[model samples]
Target: MGGSNTSHSNLKNAVLAFLVPLPSILFYLTFLYHYQDDDPNLLSPVWKWCYNHPILLANIFFFFNVNVLFWLIGLIQSSHWMIDPYWTVIPVLLVHYYANHPLAVENKYNVWRSRIVTCLTWVWSIRLSHNYFRRENWQWGVREDWRFTDMKHQYGKCWWWVSFFAVYLSQQVFLMGICMPMYVIHLENKQLDILDFVGIAICLSGIAIAYFADTQLHDFVSRNKKLKELGKPVVPNLDKGLWQYSRHPNYFGEQLWWWGLVILAWNLGYGWTFVGSLINSLCLAYVTVLVEKRMLKQDYRAEAYQLYQKTTSVWIPWFRSPLIGKSKNT
Candidate 1:
């Protein structure tokens, strides 16, 4: 009976934790919509400011959402990872809004670009959300991420408040910065150019690589799990398939996709939009390095990973290490 009660309490926390941030975010977005629906010239000064600076308005939305989540995490004793899906979800909103924006939709070329970008974003969002949901188990606070748990231990109790600045707000900044290309795309490149076609190809190819890389990793993990259940020898790490060519194929693909977006932005002449792709790439590289460092310290099959690392390219698919095929046993 005690165990049952504990489980019920955890369930209640999880649902309530997830619910805490909805009202603030939804209300802000609704306000934005109402502002947009009004005549821009006739709007009051505050509405006029929001009308002119849509990105600022979006950032405010993100800031409020993260602050709410920050409070909720403390109140519910949940992990900061509960905010993970926002990375993919916010882009869906921004892209949809940008693509349908009155200024953008009237231009035929930009409309086509917006449609393509939006469709690709939706596909990316669906795949990412599906993976996050299953991995997080929809249990919210009950299933904390290992990374945040480790940080909490390292930071002591102060992580309760520190996480708002270190994790949630920082992530919000990166997300908005990385999404600048989507906003920029709506404003310029009134006509399609050769670079636009090239960008589309690159973006599509990157998305394909990322999709397949994730799929391969998922299938391998599932196979190993089944093998373990059957008392058969299970593989330790996935170093074959798309992974054989690159140590972090999905990370490379993710960076490539952003560069493709940057190319689209470049068509309008070099500007702040390029910062989005550049920072996003740098951040992803940082994440990849962090993950590799963590795995080196903790993975049981670290020796196997070292051997795999010798032959595989770190990010570029074709640039094999000089030590390639040096370890015949691998």
Candidate 2:
């Protein structure tokens, strides 16, 4: 009857909404590179690898497909599995291999391409993972990132689902797109040139800038926590190192690195890669604004933060004078 038709229509809409962005994510994943297993992706006229080597294949679950429904469920359960983020560094390199470089055979790995990205991604992944693993309560449920909680709090309840779709799913899409360059390297027509070399240098510089900025911030925060634990004197403001130049040097560097990805794609002629960087840049800019407002709430040392603000730039690095302007608005 009418009820049955309505149910069917709702089901169709749900399916469509769920899958709207899935193709783009996977397209960037496959259009640039082929994800392979130790046992080749294809079957030699017989059966399958999943049946024989299920555990090995399962170990690569982090790189496997996910859906928005899982994302919703994760949020409802207060679980990280909904987003299921992993060291996408490897996935980036893997996809870049397919995009920029052509394959000689069906199942062979390109030595030069694989080696460069694998090393870089591994180094970055190890550095980040090691830090999180070292935290005291690194258990699965308890080890959630506070950044996610903060976002949930900021958005509030009524708009939660919208926030999940816009924030988490959208971020995953960018993560997939921005990484296409790494895999797109396989699809590149031209051989290595000065532009390529320069692009590589910029990529490295972006890496260094992001790493140091995050490291310095983490060190600054960790020092405060240590002081709190030891009952020692603590500095409320992080006006040292990268903090002296900008209120959000880490966010700035993160945005810079993503833009560097755009530059690499431009050099490689995969302009679509810029789409992800564009989103990341805007989001980071928004985060910087939010951080400034959040810091303003701490009236305990209002003058100290004001002093830091007065002498520091908000988004860009520049010499701040005591007079001219304290923040981005000024």
Candidate 3:
């Protein structure tokens, strides 16, 4: 009975997450369409100026759109999960906007670059958004991320404002930084070459690896939960397959995916801005540390996490110790 009620509540939360911002998003899109179309009566001088600068218009729209949704959901549910899907969704939107620009269709090389980047980004975004939806059970506002919960605990009442500036805004800044490649890629007409092919391969492989790792982890975790609920002996942790090789093969794959984009940029001679990928890698490293720290604090799995950390690579897939020999002996 208790489990049923909990499940029902979770379903409700997920539904609310889907429904809450949907109206606002629809309204915003309608407004944006009219604004971009330059509806004669509704067009203010400022908006007309904005339409002339599509990038600026897009940046502002997304910034406010995300912020408004975050604030609404955060205030209602006190959770940060509503922001999860935007990380994948935003980049695709950005790239799509640039890809469809009139100039993008003018040159053969530009069209290829635009198509490749957009298609790859769309593929990645769909996969990520699917993963997030499944992982969160679509309960965006209800399933607050543990990191945000910890911050709330630390900040007490002030987390409301702090989260806006510290979490949401900072993430937007980082997202824009990493998206520099997509932004600048449309500026050049460099034909696709061997490096671009290599980049595409690497990007696709990274996505596959990450997707596989997530699926494995999901299966293991779900099985563990079911065993626990059935009052049976549960698996200690997910330490088989890819998890055996790295504490975070998914994160490793994620880093590789960005570096793959960097390779695309480098092939076009868009140098230095490839630093975006480096920044993304550094951010992923920080997130890995945070996740490991959280896992270490779990009373049931602390020692196991420590052992895993010592034996497996943190963000790279490899064995750090002779666990193979120990396993064979056992």
Best by TM-score: 1
Q: Enumerate residue pairs that collide in model 1.
A: none
TM-score of 1: 0.85
Q: Show the lowest summed lDDT stretch of 10 residues, model 2.
A: 54-63
Provide the overall lDDT of each model, using Cα atoms, as 2-decimal numbers: 0.73, 0.55, 0.74
TM per candidate:
0.85, 0.66, 0.84
Candidate RMSDs in order: 3.3, 11.6, 3.8
Residues 11-78, model 3: lDDT tens digits: 77667655654553564466467665766456777645654665676567666767766666677766
Per-residue lDDT of 1-330 in model 1, one digit per residue for the tens? Answer: 987976786677657645755765575566568667777777778767756667776777677766655546554655565566656677887786666544554677877888888887887788777666655544444555666777889889887777777677777777787787788788865788899889888888788888788878878878988998999977867877889889888888777777787788777775667776777778777778888877677566677777766667888887556675566645
TM-score of 2: 0.66
lDDT of 2 by residue, 229-256 (tens): 9999677677777767888866666566
Worst 10 residues of 1 by lDDT: 135-144
- Please tell me which model should have the higher lDDT, number 2 or number 3: 3
**Residue 76 error, candidate 2, Å:** 6.3
Give the backbone clash total of model 2.
18
Better of 1 and 3 by TM-score: 1
What is the C-alpha local distance difference test score of candidate 3?
0.74
List the candidate 3 regions with Cα displacement exceeding 4 Å.
1-48, 102-105, 138-140, 327-330
